[model samples]
Target: MEKKRSFPKFLSITLIILVVVGAFIGWKAYQTFIGPSVTDKEEFFYVHTNDTYDLVLARLKSQGIVKHPDLFDFAAKKMDYPNSVKAGRYKLIPGMSNRRLIGNLRGGYQEAVKFRFANVRLKESFAALLGNSFEADSTKFNDILNNEAVAEQYGFTTDNFFSMFVPNTYDIYWNTSPDKIVARFHNEYKKFWTDERKQKAQAVNLTPIEVSTLASIVKGEALHVDEMPKIAGLYLNRLRKGMLLQADPTVIFANNDFTIRRVLNRHLTIDNPYNTYRYKGLPPGPIMMPSIASIDAVLNPTDHDYIYMCAEADFSGYHAFAVTVAEHQVNARKFQKALDERNIKK
Candidate 1:
């Protein structure tokens, strides 16, 4: 046939060509999948949009979420995502591809943090909550609470900043600014006091601010929701009769330290406007943040003739209502006896 065909030469040339093509394809595929595919070991990641690329890269490296930050940067740039990046706190998970991550970042998806304000003391507790979300200056927040101009602009008297903040669960972005957080509380408070509430405030011959202050008192005194209306009635009766409300919570609030576990006669003498025992009427302002239930109680008090109340000796989270000071003294004595027996002086 053909002069003893050089079979080895033909075979060698064919093998060389096949090897080159295979290597080229393998390299291309590696480049495409290596950065995007989820590795077997990765679990979760936290991405911060506010961070610089270098900072993000550093965080990713520290968290072991990525092997190379440069890879992410290059991919994001290629996909035109760097310019469209949105700021937020994100949670990254396993099996997320580069394309998906880019989409999440660009769409501004964020994880929400739920903050609850139920049963909170106004000054100290609210400050702590604000600090959790922002690097808030507690002094500044307190100053604003006491600022006459700021209070007036927000339809509150400078003396009653606590009344303007109602307690509720708020869903906030992780990095929300302190001012914005405070503004949201103010807005929620405003929403709760609709036109109907305004009429009720006028009907009671109380300003919205006054109503809130009374609600704060109710919130502090009533241990249970069922007792709210009765407590509200007692205070309203006192207001109508021009008697001292003489609420113990007011004395506690006036102390400001919040550490006075017991409202002794000595504690009542502390010179502060919030001491209803010393002052004849409502304090200069609200003592604590009121719940909507408390607000409603103040707006719609029970029609009872009760003018006094004392915690039951049972400490059952219910109050003993009375129409006379003598009756209240009997209840008080019973409660004090219980406190003595249980060593619960506070």
Candidate 2:
């Protein structure tokens, strides 16, 4: 009788201990799964290329993003997340559970970065500017951008590849591959040149690339956005007459001297195809990345008979347009006198 009573007592004590241990384990698990694991402050965390599991943990701890690094570590290990780390920019919210965090990482569910750029001029400059949106080094981007074979595959050459980029904003992922970015741009270009726009180009008797080249010249000449169409018309008039476009912007582009505020006869004699005074047709490439406004101005050029434009004598940003040689000479003389008064000799 005594042994049986003692055995019952021992069994009760063992059950109590087991319950306590189970409760503790359950609590820990609940904490790991349902408890807040990330601080409510930071918005994002960067998982760099090839960042090891240990490094990510360290980063989390160092950035103070993780409220319980030890618990997260345990959860990550249990989920087998170390070997499949995804490189990207990820958004984080405050009071997030480790379960969600680890699951998101495992799923590679990073959001795309908001990328915006414009007014890119040179190929090298564009490569460097665009490289900031991705993980790869800019030099690799530059090489790819300059590769003639690659550009030609996209209906462009390295010489005219600058025309490929339409100046506008974009949204891109941080780890987006270079080729995909190029493809996206090409798609955007195709979408931009709608059937109606293509018809307009046909009416102007210029190819898309030719229009871009002319638009670049027009963009360089005028400051007022309203004047772009008129400038386009003036250049078109010159083109239709088989006369030289004689664009000062083209001369500046040929000389590769952006500091020349005024074009001189010396700059025109650079013996380069970019100089419209020397070359009867469009330059082989765009002088700079033309703006959408400029491109549209070309396709929808105002129909006019004006063939000459000279800076106004009043130092206004506007230009004095003329339809006759005598009228152009008068405008030119007035502008020259103004320039002499300002002592702005090239």
Candidate 3:
């Protein structure tokens, strides 16, 4: 009977040992795969474009993302995440698991930047804006923009290159290269010029680029959306009648001075191709990035015999349209009187 008791006692001890081992294994598995591993203060962790796995691991520890680096290292290696590190901005949940973090990193799931701009007047400023927004260098972006060969490759001159970027909010990757950014905008430009838009542009006797240029002028001239089509019609009438565009915004652009409240006689006499008062037809390029509303206004201009426009006397952000020079002069005198009354000297 004592021997039987001893056998049962030994079996019980064996069962206890097995249970302890199983519990330990289960705890370890949970710690490695399911337990919270990330504890960063910030909501995002950045992985640069050329960061190695070792570098990323070090960053994880330094950034307080992982308390136990060795466990993270082991997991990374096990998942073969070292070979597939993508550069991007990754979101960090407060209590994420090692498996999930590594999976996201390996899978290249990252947030996109909402790239946006408006009223950008110069290519340099455009490049600067891009540099501030992306990882690419500003100087490199400017270089590519000013490169005649590169512009030629894109079937554009440096003069008309800025027209390719239609201003609006775009979902773009932060790590996108400068060249790729240009290429992407070029693709968007192509997409924007649909067959219907092309046909309308042709009917208006303007190429896509020329339409953009004219649209920029129209945008410059009008602030009210309802007035855009009327202003566009006036400009088109001038173009058809072989009259100079005589756009004040072009004078401001040529002077590189945005503070000009009034375009004086001296401003009109400036010997620059962009001075529409001196040169005929649209400027070699856009004076500013045109809005979609302005572009469409040019595409679907109001049919009218109007050939001249002047800002209204009441500062209502509207224009006075005319079919004859005498009527235009009357509107101009009213605006001049208003400007004089307001002391709007250039």
Query: Which candidate ranks first by lDDT, i.e. highest?
Result: 3
Model 3 Cα lDDT, one tens digit per residue, 1-346: 4544345778899999999999998888777877898886778788889999889998998888875778888888989999999998788898899999899999999888899998887889988999888888789889988888888887888988888889988888888888888898888999999999999999999999999999999999888989899889989999998999999999999998899998999878788999999999999999988889999999999999998888999999998888888999999999999999999999
- Best-to-worst order by lDDT is 3, 2, 1
lDDT of 2 by residue, 239-317 (tens): 9999999999889988989899778888888999899999997889998888889999999898999999899999878
Model 1 scores a TM of 0.82
TM-score of each: 0.82, 0.86, 0.87
By lDDT, is 2 or 3 better? 3
Show where candidate 1 strays beyond 4 Å. 1-50, 67-70, 80-85, 134-148
Flag the better candidate by TM-score, 1 or 2: 2
Q: List the residue pairs that clash in candidate 2.
A: 40-94
RMSD values for the candidates in order, in angstroms, are 3.9, 3.8, 3.0
* CA-lDDT, candidates in order: 0.75, 0.87, 0.89
State which candidate, 1 or 3, has the greater TM-score.
3
Please give, for residues 95-213, the per-residue lDDT of candidate 1 as tens digits.
Answer: 56665666666676766667777666766666766665544456666666667787787777767777777777778775666567668878988797899999988887788889888
Clashes of 3: 0
